[model samples]
Target: MNLLPAYVLLDLETTGATPARDRITEIALIRYENGEEVARWQTLVNPHMPIPPFIQTLTGIGDDMVQAAPDFESVAPRLYQYLDGAVLVAHNVRFDHGFLKHEFQRIGIILRQKVLCSVKLSRLLYPQHRSHGLDAVIQRHQIVVAARHRAMGDVEAVAAFIEAAGRELGEDRVALEVARLMTAPSLPPGLDPSLLDELPETAGVYLFFGADDAPLYIGKGVNLRSRVLAHFSGKTTDMAQAVRRVEWLETVGEFSALLLESHLIKTRQPLHNSLQRRQRQLCAWRLAAAPDIHPQAQLVREDAIDPTALGDLFGLYRSRKHAEEALRGIARNHALNPRLLGLESGDVRASSEPDAQHYLRLKLALAAQRLKDWPYPGKIAVREYDATSQRTQLHVFEHWCYLASVDNEADLHDVLAQRSTPVFDLDIYKLLQQVLLPPAKTGAKPAIGGLEIVHFQDGYDQQKTSSSSQ
Candidate 1:
């Protein structure tokens, strides 16, 4: 039996991994019909951009080689003819398909075809093998190639692997696997499949909208495409089916995605986002100042939160009742007086300790929840950069509040000039703590991994001073 009636074994060598930002430098494919090779095509297309040195080193196709070659637009029609009405076969087929769809889109041609992944085929055929990468398959099956990393070379390797699979694991079984792998992922009837192709595999926030442009859900992911596609995989859900439109905003990194996700969820109040909705009555415990004779703790509401006194704040609770419940739990566990904590009306004799000792014990119990003081003397901008897209985002923060994310110096200046008192957010505070706080054992300074920290002096006139990573 023929493994596939018609299929094209394809591969692409691109400038980088991201299809939305990077350009394809080369394309190669071999069309097969009835288990026989009918046509072979390969070309070096000018990407209209400089191929990075590392990519050139890997693919052995440099600027000079593609200088005279036709650009993707020039080769679009012929390439489409070769690809149309055939199952696109490749190792890690999504990577190749994503690039093809994007390139075709640039020329106003929507390229959509059934796909079969040889890597998945290898995994399904040889379940014991841990690695199904092309290199691993080539070495395991002893398939020789005229070249490697180059587009044509990788295509040949994948084609050889499929042919060998037909021989080793009966043609019937190979064909069965091909049929199973060709089954496309289901998409909502109202949603467009092309939208999934447009999603970049980068850090970003995505919003799903239902009928009448009502928001169904809002979420963030490092790979927006993979995460969004996962919703349609396996068992379908009501939210996935209700989704009629999809929108996304790409970010420089995961931190920015997170901040945006939190902000959007609270503001938009999507139908499916139950947990991240705005906590209007959010409250926290503010410890009393030293030598004060007032209550040891006071419940402060969200609007009343003082950014300057964030260091004196404790656990962020959902409401007044939650705050009281938490303090009661701390008082019971630490054997402190409830009257001293302002939790009850009458004095209860939990312990005969002095007021200062009781306060000390309460403070000790709440130490883990106590907010950290802002390490910087002034506002600081956490700079996140993406090398692939050449994008930069400066996330400005005061205390634990996220002020704004700016891309240009002029915008940054504007943000500084229009500085207002930053409001403390529970979600932003938690995110910043997780990213900026150092480990307890190390006793090191707070630092964001792989990000630059810049300090602003006093006003818009103050120049940005870069500090060592902290």
Candidate 2:
């Protein structure tokens, strides 16, 4: 590609795919500027750890090869010089770049650079081409490779492909593609592109901020970078226009992301997020009237929704109107007295007929069997593991109540010691029902997965200790 801007065609052989845990075994790059290759560099790095046998077989670089080679710390300065101002290029560049970043960061070095993926470039440039790996590119361009899995060999193949593209498609076309690949499209006015580069391609929560860094919307995804960019990469809407800045927090896995997203959305009540607001005022309909009295349905707020005290609750609704409307629909279908359910304004005395009693029985029978109660005896902690981070968090729940979450035992004790009122959230109930309950038996809700459910009775140890002391 004819360019004043330099590009470092890079490749790395690593111990494993993960950047955080794996070590780089080899490094190589071909530096180019103004359509000419100025220099090429390759080095075997001593990982200070044993390389797996499978890795050795794949790259043909054994322990003996790297025994005398310099480690990454020794080669950092020179490698940084080659990468400092250039657009980093590699097949699946994120993998190589993520590995190098972790390596550099360990020694107190921050490596941030614009990255272009040759694999993506190939896919974009040659839409008809299926595979864009080094071997595929080598075969496609009729370029012979001296080494197959070696770092320099892969770099050479990538360089040759660029050269071929420039020759066949013209220098201007090649440069245009390079420039396009390097930059993100139609980012919000003042929001920097470098911010996008800062995001990791891992599970995380992302927040969009408007004028004063006020959270506009918060969302979670398995891949943060792609999902975040997908927002601005499309046609600029009100969300795109309003987003002046962005922030993100990376999690170990999807489960952690899910928990954090739910928690934040419930607490923060971000302006743009309408679905899962604080739900502090969540309410449900509970049949409260006796047979002699008119059949009455009352709204039970979260704080007062103690299932032990208040039995036989009906539809969970977000607002009073919604609850009334639901009751109205149920009454109409059963031809129960609308005045009794507080749906239509009328005299309750107008419904003393035996038909009214029959309709009330019909309504209760229709809504009776499915008023679900807490299946668990007491407080339960569902342990969730983040495999990438190897972190475990205990999600403490009681009677379908999310009391608190703790990452360690001490914090878990503290969470258990503190007594918070069981706020019966409609969303939480539905979510837990869908996940924790059985679908075949309930037939009313979906069963998501089999979770590790543990039951802990509150203050049991204290009560036993007091009895023994007496």
Steric clash pairs (candidate 2): none
Q: What are the per-residue Cα lDDT tens digits for candidate 2 across 359-379?
A: 566456446534577765566
- Looking at model 2, residue 288 earns an lDDT score of 60
- Model 1 worst lDDT window (10 residues): 437-446
Determine which window of 10 residues in candidate 2 has minimal summed lDDT: 461-470
Task: Write one digit per residue (lDDT tens) for candidate 1, span 1-470.
Answer: 36778888999999887788899999999998887888999999899999999999988999999999999999988888887778888898878888888898888877767777788899999999999998999999999999999999999898888778878988789888888876657998998877744666678999999988988899999879778888999999999999999999988877788889999998899999988888798999987776245578988899998888877889889889998999999889888778888887775355467777777878899999887888767777767767656677888888888888888667888776655889888888888776553323233333444455566775644333432242
Could you tell me how far off, in angstroms, the CA of residue 78 lies in candidate 1 after the best superposition? 1.4
Model 1, TM vs. native:
0.82
Local distance difference test scores for all models: 0.82, 0.74
